[model samples]
Target chain A: MALSDVYDFYRRMEDENVILSFKGEFTSELLTSILHIMETKMVTMGISPKMKKRVFNVLVECFQNLYHHIEATGDSPKQIALQKSALIMVIHENEKIIVRTGNYIPSNGIEKLKERLSFVNGLTEEKLRELYQNRLLKNKLSSKGTAGLGLIDIARKSKNKLGFEFIEINENTSFFCLDVVIE
Target chain B: MEILLLEGSAKTPEINFNQDTGVLELRGRSIPENSIEFFKPLNDWVDIYGSSPKETTQIEVRLEYFNTSSSKCILDLFKRLEQLDGNSTEVKVNWYFEKDDEDMEEAGVDYEAIVDLPFKIIEVEEI
Candidate 1:
């Protein structure tokens, strides 16, 4: 990354109205600190309390999704390297805030991830609420104690279909990006 | 047994389970990195509290935010209270939210739908 390249990226972030953009390895400790920063930032902005709460909640779910997915990756040098470069960006636009995260997913997992995203985005509000309720009752947490409720909750909170893309990085892995927009 | 009081941190909720007063309170943010571990003792406390009857059990939840993992643990805690509700123990959950926060209020409503316990969604001027 050249100095000019860094400046260019900074300019682009500013152009996009990014409030925060983080690119690095994500650990549980780092997640807490980032959340604290976000909370303080929201408070400083003096946005509506309800809006602040919505953005904060969406950010938490996004960070946890990244944290859990990264932890699930086995200890391969390449995977770890890829994990360290994961990106999260929070942008404010058109009276709405957008929380976006990008990370690597093993090729085999991309299909399932896409399907789940599609399923969540496809549901009507009533069905989504029903699904959330049923999942709350029946969805057993994985060994990591995540009940796979992150996506559904994000959808519910955002009240928008999730935006996602999978870029083919290589034969064995892909870059997965997810965005939730909160109004 | 004894009262269970755990201080809140940046990532975990404050838990004050008073066996004597039957006023169990969970407050602050609950986005702990290891929510299962953080909430284990609370679950165990609920189990013990459920077994021993109190004339009235009141749970006050005033969380600013919680991640998905913590949400599961919260449901588990509420389930324990629901169990107590069945056996003649008057269990009530006072879910508090900031007056401007409809999302938190809705979260309380979500829990109310899932758990068969009486919930009082109270809106305060500020948390």
Candidate 2:
């Protein structure tokens, strides 16, 4: 089988309709460019103004997560390597916008990620609202990295399940794909 | 009193405040790397301006986007203005949002809910 065949199978199983595909070094410039393009498209498509903001907000959070957790090796081998990766966005027939982002994840980080996803996925809408309000009241002044509330914010905004899949690339690394949908 | 103008970056917004005219404006995105560090001085300036209240103080906020932390700081700023209600100064807040941007309009309403001040939500065409 060819590489496209593998991608096709995975795409079918994930129930994603790939409308845009990109693969390159995930630099800050590239991320911002992508956001700008997406925002333009959202406006052109006549998406509601509220939904446009929501889409942009979700994109920023997801891209930041990929940047923070990407694996790398060099002079600073253990440093979070700002390497290139593949990002795919799909618009489902049901009017749901799905974003699939893939990046190299350290093998040891899988369990922690799973735990966080599980905790976020278990919350009801009311519970998530309470958590958000509580965080706002008690933790607004805290810095971003220190709080690690990005995942919770994503969960609350998306109002969808966080679906993830891992492919073991080698013993020390794995290609992790995260799927988030905005309906 | 001096007018300090700052441009917006990928993380922050453009800040324009004129002490002479008492016209303060913040527009564009706001997701600064450090929320407190970025907003502390702005808050301080508002406090200083509130002391010797101007005859007509107008604050225009036309932010396209801001993170939750920045939202709190904005609330604090509005509260400060609300405190100067009976003073000789006439304070007015004009929150501008895109014509179809309901999220921004709702945010304006949310800020209005907390402060007892003259706040107006204006819809503008996207430039």
TM-scores for all predictions: 0.93, 0.71
Model 1: lDDT to the true structure: 0.85
Clashing pairs in 1: none
Q: What is the C-alpha lDDT profile of model 1 across A1-183, one tens digit per residue?
A: 887898899899899999888898877788777777877887787778778777877888888788777734558887567655689999988888899999888889988889999999889988998898888889888878788888888998898999999999888778889989998
Superposed by TM-score, candidate 2 places the C-alpha of residue B26 at a distance from the truth, in angstroms, of 1.6
Clashing pairs in 2: none
| Candidate 2: tens digits of C-alpha lDDT, residues A86-153 | 56464644777777778777778888988888888999977876675556545645454423556777
lDDT of 1 by residue, B42-90 (tens): 8888888887868899999999888878888899989878888858579
Per-residue lDDT over B1-127 for candidate 2, one digit per residue giving the tens place of the 0 to 100 score: 5575888887778999887887889989876534677777787887777778779889899999776656667776777777765676788999999987766776687677556788899999971
Provide the lDDT at B81 for model 1.
84
Candidate 2 CAPRI level = acceptable
Supply the DockQ value of model 1.
Answer: 0.77
Chain B TM-score for all candidates, comma-separated: 0.95, 0.92
**Which ranges of candidate 2 are over 4 A from the true structure?**
A1-16, A69-94, A140-147, A168-172, B7-11, B31-44, B47-58, B68-96, B109-127
